[model samples]
Target: MRYLRFTNWLTEIDRMSGPISAIWFEEVRRHAGTDAAHVYGGLMATLTAWAELRGVPCEGVPVGTIKRHATGKGNAPKHAMIEAARARGFDPVDDNEADAIALLLWAIETKGGLA
Candidate 1:
């Protein structure tokens, strides 16, 4: 049921966004609990499979890499990431939003603004 909901959400986003050039996600190396780890793995597998079915490029960025790219610190805290996004002219409402913004920026910069 959860996987279905997640795929439905992805479909909704794809419909709204038009053609997806690529997909990027944060690659978490560790989880505090086994259940969380399992959930992450399941979601990741679902996401990759979905992307593959659609022929879209899907990649994972490391947590430390995102933090360093956003705030010049590999282990930057949530508040620092938020500040970094704000500095980049984004008003993120939460850490997740901020992280997304940071990842977008990273992708754009790394891919020479064509991504």
Candidate 2:
């Protein structure tokens, strides 16, 4: 359902602009149960469907990985991610959304593509 909403949003965004490089799923696990494998698989499917629909690129990365890469520690605190976000050249007001976007960009850079 969330994935579907995201795809819809992406499609709407695409309609306004041109195809983009990727999509970001922030704290995606929070939206799932204890089933990690199922969550990841569902993520892949959602991304694939979104990519196919928009003819754009897409990828998914865990929120913690983003915090780790952005903040240094895999289990860094939120304040740490906030500090790191500022240090990384983003304004403080942009922390949450920017962190999410950064996480998505990191995933896209890491993965080849949605396919």
Candidate 3:
């Protein structure tokens, strides 16, 4: 159901603009004991597979890379990351939303797209 909604959302975007040239995600792993990490990892895997099946160009950036891009430190703490987003004039709701915005900016810059 989530995938369906996401695909539908993508379709809507395509209708509004054009085909999305690519998709980007921050690569993450559960490592050992975190439940949210495991769930998000699984969801990302599913989304990646679906995107591949649909022939959408899907790419992932490591968490460290995103951190470095945003804050000059690959091991930035969540509070630091939030601060970095604020520095960019974004009033993020939380670290996760701030990270997503940063990731989106990274994708645009990396893909040579207008931001």
Q: Which model scores highest in lDDT?
A: 1
Expressed as tens digits, the lDDT of each residue in 59-94 for candidate 3 is: 778899889888999999999989999999999999
Task: Give the per-residue lDDT of model 1 (tens digit) for 71-112.
Answer: 999999999999999999999999999999998888888882
Better of 2 and 3 by TM-score: 3
Compute the lDDT for candidate 1. Answer: 0.90
When summed lDDT is taken over every stretch of 10 residues in candidate 1, the lowest stretch is 106-115
- TM-scores for the candidates: 0.92, 0.60, 0.74
**Model 1 alpha-carbon miss at residue 88, Å:** 1.0
Global fold similarity of model 1 (TM-score): 0.92
Per-residue lDDT over 34-95 for candidate 2, one digit per residue giving the tens place of the 0 to 100 score:
67767667767877886877666445566677776676677777677777767767766646
TM-score, candidate number 3: 0.74
Q: In model 2, which runs have C-alpha deviations exceeding 4 angstroms?
A: 1-8, 31-48, 104-115
RMSD of each: 2.0, 4.9, 3.6
